[model samples]
Target chain A: MSWTMTRKALWDLRWTTFWYALGLALYTLLIAFVYPTFREQSAQFEEIVRNYPEALLRAFGIEPGQGLSSSFGAFMHAEAYGFVWPLVAAIFVIMSGAAAVAQEVERGTAELWLSVPESRPRLLAGKLVALLVGMLAVVGVSVLSLLVAAPLVDAELPADAAAQLGVVLLDFLIAVAGISVLFSSIFSERGKAAALAAAVVLAMYLAWVIAGLSERFEWLRYLSIFTAYRPREALEGSSVSWAGLLALLAIGLGSMLASLAIFRRRDILV
Target chain B: MDSLPIQVNGLTRFYGKTRGVDDLAFTVERGEIFGFLGPNGAGKTTTIRLLMGLIQPTRGSARIFGLDCWRDATAVKSHVGYVPGDARLYEAMTGAQFLDFLAGFRPGIDPARRRMLVERFDVDLSRTIKHLSKGNRQKLALVQAFMHDPPLLILDEPSSGLDPLMQRELLTFLREEQARGKTIFLSSHLLYEVEQVADRVGIIRDGRLVAVATIEELKRQRTRRMEVAFSMPIDLAQLASVDGVQVLQVREGGRWVELGVSDGLPVLLRRLSELPVVDLVYAPPDLDSVFMGYYQRQEAITGERAR
Candidate 1:
């Protein structure tokens, strides 16, 4: 019944979080060592910017006067923090949530847990909290990696950049956790839930990219989760967009509530 | 009208078009060790699940200690202990951790009781559940269920993976728990096991409650077997007319006969006394025969013998 007990129970998956963080660190190293060499040797950047100026610019989100080195770093950040890191974090959050319920049902562990005095809602809430902690840990690792590499790249560690990154990471994590909960409530299979969540995340990312490239289809931006999330603007000293933050939070919390409602009413298979 | 610890009335559940449990109703009075007897797919597990409030019943309702099972599941669970037919633990957790996790949920679990249960079951607490043998895992589950000392215990195949000695120990523990006025609702395919502990037995087949009665009543209703060797040759055809006996077998010499009798065993004995009965053997009905008779009767009534 205690929040602290539930929090500790949620933290039980720390080993999984540790591995994910380690993977993120290794990925950071690979990008730092390999990407700069590609930019120095080839006209890859110029060719990409020229052929599809809007597409390339939208992809990397660089300003007009930014130099190749900084643009390259921004490009790396776009790839890592924007898509790769968020994707990884989202997958982890979804996996954790899906595993929390569906895996227990699959392996018949839920029966044991349910046999106790814990209410269904409290058990579910505890799992959700655990998943949030996992997402937070992933975001923390991304921030740590950026901080470690920023000095090495001669870039000052700005407080605004840190805050922006933190918000983006947290927002993405919440969104994915919500989606995962919804999927878990509907599907008892862990693999199927994770796959469906991944598909949704990818579709949303693609929608955002397509929206940004064409003015004719600007309306599509409203449908994309990534559209409301703008980390770069925040990094450039702009205030965090409260409207976008509120929208994301609403969707996340709403989906989670729907999941709990359904879960309480539905029959558990295992 | 009795103070039944568990009461189910017209309970029904379905999965798509398939019926999981169909109009099941029964009761277990306080301090009674009741047995739910059934075959492989006879809705025994479904009934247990419904009682546990793990699933919603499509029709009617189940209650534990006069509280709605689904609505008051948390309250009921606190006072009830369950061991599923397939007792699977969190494979990632050590045996001790799983026990501790379960213990943390309840308010007043005695550490000494926990220690005593584990020791009695001979379960190793240090190893992860994944690494333990099936028997050990079952023992761990038993320890968990009994450690809290709840008033009502629902076990499905509680002896499935246990060794003979452990099974006996568990049965003894159940007896002691019953002595303390606890109620137990257990389901098992092993009729003998049920016979050892249960005061009342409910037989289910094809998702229907075929019969519910006391063990003595069931035994009384069962066909009694008697083998007799007479000094004088007895006519098999004449013995068939004996009041309560159905001749099952006859030897070529007509000196020995096996009869399946229902009631009037005293009349059969009187008839046997008229002849010089060199040797006679009367055996009480075993559990297997009782189950077979029930299934056969059910098959005839339903006209679907294959299942």
Candidate 2:
């Protein structure tokens, strides 16, 4: 609601947005350039995938003997979405979210902001909105790279693949950012907030990996936020669960609301 | 006109079991320069924070402009311009940009006033905040708080990093604001800073209101420090036995005796003239001696009488 506050937040975090977006675009370009070699060696790679251990393939979210190398979207899933995008989103969320509140407190700058006539909710909302815009830019660059690279390789990414990748990637980013902001709101120390948020994301990733390797631990997958985004399946134009997407959206909104509730009543130590 | 700019009644804040400020009740008239004085960790910042609505009171309430500080914080804050004890400006932006960003929130802030303040502070508005030194940053904060020209100014340790000249400039600026009928609440641990401009002062110690008096009243109870170097060693008991003279220190085998005299200066002077004296010096009173005199349970000055 406060455009001035939002503009300040964006200006403060412009470099962070630029670097993350650049990294995603470069990584996507690398994968696109290597796609031709992967397509030529598809048969051999398929044989290798078939012979690979089932547990490892499941952990990597790759179906054994499938046509992963045959499609650029599927290749992107196994190479980027299965891990890289989530990791990037987690790091971005942790840094920006902590900077939103915890960094202000530690540096004793929140006093200046809170002394103004604006309410706490409005200030926080503007910061969070700016962060969301940054995340969108990062993911948008990745999508643009894929669209630009696919035509040069004589490969077409299905419309469904492009749309689903953007949606689910954004969903995942929002969820992780919400959790980061929640922790940032609770702690006055930015380092502590970032550390806790990172630990939670890593723990969730580990839970999903371990749970995928065995049937007995399958219940752990539900606890991981990453489980809600089945990017590979979504790219294949199958198994796109609206329920899962909604769950992720709900997590994002819920955590943000909780942060607002606590931040409104809590003392700003700075 | 508006119910005394600040009214705090039995305001107390407890950090869990530890007290931040205890049973503090005070009021500031509409245009008086009220100084809240205390040592470090004596709860001056806590009181400021509570009034700013950055923290809630554990026991009582603070009202500004007749509105509850907690429930109607936005309304209360709209009338107040505050400078925190440790002000950290946005280091990435130029001073002009930071001031512009602050001015955007308040509708009544005039651009001409902002320009005037920037010129008065003599800070390079084009330089990034990180490039500015500590004193320059303080000047930036002062410009931000004063540019808006709010009716009430709550400043905590406002002169901490300024050079002596700038400090004097700030005192003069505050006097001008006072002339314009602004209600100023200045909090400081340094006694002399408050004494220089404060119309009234409230001394807090150990999370309690120890004393509150006008500068005139506090000066009335002040003691003078006297030192004498005798031609020969004299019995120190002669000075210690006086009604209002207390021996503070004895140096050089009692030839030099430092004394704190509140009421018996004449009697001590009479006795000194009778003894063999080589050198005598009288030092004007400092706040420490005045505080020491009051700390020893001399006539207790209470805020109630001032109210």
Candidate 3:
């Protein structure tokens, strides 16, 4: 990858990265601040969670046998990691991947870029590296915020919970980034790329929810990337599915390579 | 390097079933300024994009410096500087930053030349691109293209948004690049601009190249307008007999006659000199009229072939 191009891509995304990191960090801190109440009223919270219907529990990303007041880490996973983190990271990845090529084409900047000596793959690799860096930086802010707010809320997290959560978030981002890049590679408009990626992510989440409602729909879980990221299972024990994690990473890598190939052969419509 | 800096053979492109350019074959020699001229949607930009390897041709190929444009585009592009028709700079970046970003893509770009171009174009590099006017944005594009000092320059509508003074500066710069042995392939619809700078011009119409000629050759083919006021009325039959001269009108009761002269201007002048003892005025054809002449001729030929 060309560092010059990578640096410029990162520089171009600086403001977006800043705002995303800030927002995610604030959300993590809010969860940390509210952890104390859940711990104190554990019985009441458990009763309320048990009374909810099974489909409603699934919709809220509440796994079977996992209570909201069981552990600080479990509470954090349900409140932030289960749904909010994936959504936020999906937005970040969509924007980054869409801006990678489609946005440039829409703004007519791709013409200037392709006119240079850099090969198409090199250009794409640089942008991908930049995006990965941005995602990591945003996740780093959440980790830092969680660590800083833990003591204030009198909460206890597993020693490696932050690191495990970081891995899960990274996996989520890379999976969505793959879809984003795939859509961006096909469309010349950033709006179209972002919209398609958002639709796919939302559909995947709904597929997982709808699948959990009945045994007949269980097959739909395979269609949703969320199935690969069981944060509740990861928080309870060290039982994160290595296969699922690898699958998420593999999907991202596979999609990225496919995007590069398509971009190489396709006409830049600017 | 090949003596011909550019070589395109049977280049064709289609967007679905719609033709972009068809069977385009041309060559641009070293140090020559070849102008690709056509009105909007006539496939000028499509051909340029093919040469730059920005888009693939449906059939046929384009080569630069003897390297296949698509297969060896990275190596070919190392020696080419391009100014696209749409000059879109990163809005958040200052002009200086934008140039720097482009320069970073190529390893051998000259800082000295970049500075010179910045000064020559009279652009304020300190301001963000969003704040710059259209003309200033064009200046920044020109600077980035020239700063690399490549052997070949492909400019598509390079002066679209520039003011008259900046346009003149651009013309001067192009001439200087030619003197330094750079190959230039510029596309434009502005007849006068092409006529002023192009050594050879290719006119495309409806996705086909209709005419290709040197400036002087095109001038020779264009009809010349003339008006002659004779001291006395002469035999209109004698004037009509002159080769390639058509009488347009007889004003002042046949004392003054307007004529269109094509190839035999010298013969027409001689015939007029024998009788016009009063006055004469001649207007050489403008580039627009010359351009139209080719289009009309092509239509007539197409019509005849249909018969």
DockQ leader: 2
Put down candidate 2 lDDT per residue, B1-307, tens digits, no spaces.
3588999899999999999999998998888899998888999999999999999999999989898888888888889989889789989889989988998888878888888888887878999999999999999998888988999999999998999999988888898899999999999887678888999988887788878889887766666678899988998888899987888889999899898777777788889988999998887555565667676444335544556
Q: Candidate 1's residue-wise lDDT over B78-180, tens digit each?
A: 8789999889887878999888888877768899999998888988999988999999999998889989998899999999989999899889999999999
lDDT of 3 at B2: 52
lDDT, candidate 3, at A173: 87
Using TM-score as the measure, name the better of candidate 2 and candidate 3: 2
Model 2 spans with C-alpha error above 4 angstroms: A64-69, B224-228, B235-244, B263-286, B298-307
**Per-residue CA lDDT of candidate 3, range B1-307, in tens?**
8547999899999999999999988888899999888888899989988888889889999999998888888888998989999778899999989988998888877778888998999989999999999999999999988898999999999999999999999999999999999989989988778878999988887898878889887776666667889887878887788866668789887899887666676777677778855888887555455655565566668999999
Distance from true location, Cα of A17 in model 1, Å: 0.8
Clashes of each: 0, 0, 0
Candidate 1, A1-270: lDDT as tens digits: 335336545657788889998898678656655555654754666555555566655655443344233443454555566557666777778787677667777778778888888788787887777777777777777677766775675555576667776787688678778888888877878898888877887787777878876788878888877876766555444577878877887778888888888777767777
Give the Å error, residue B238, model 3: 9.4
**Tens digits of lDDT, candidate 3, A34-139:** 8888888889988988888887777778875665646877888878877787778778889889878899888889888899898998888888899999999998
Lowest-sum lDDT 10-residue window in model 3 chain B:
B284-293
Give Cα distance to truth, residue B162, candidate 3, Å: 1.7
Q: Label model 3 with its docking quality class.
A: medium
Docking class of 1: medium
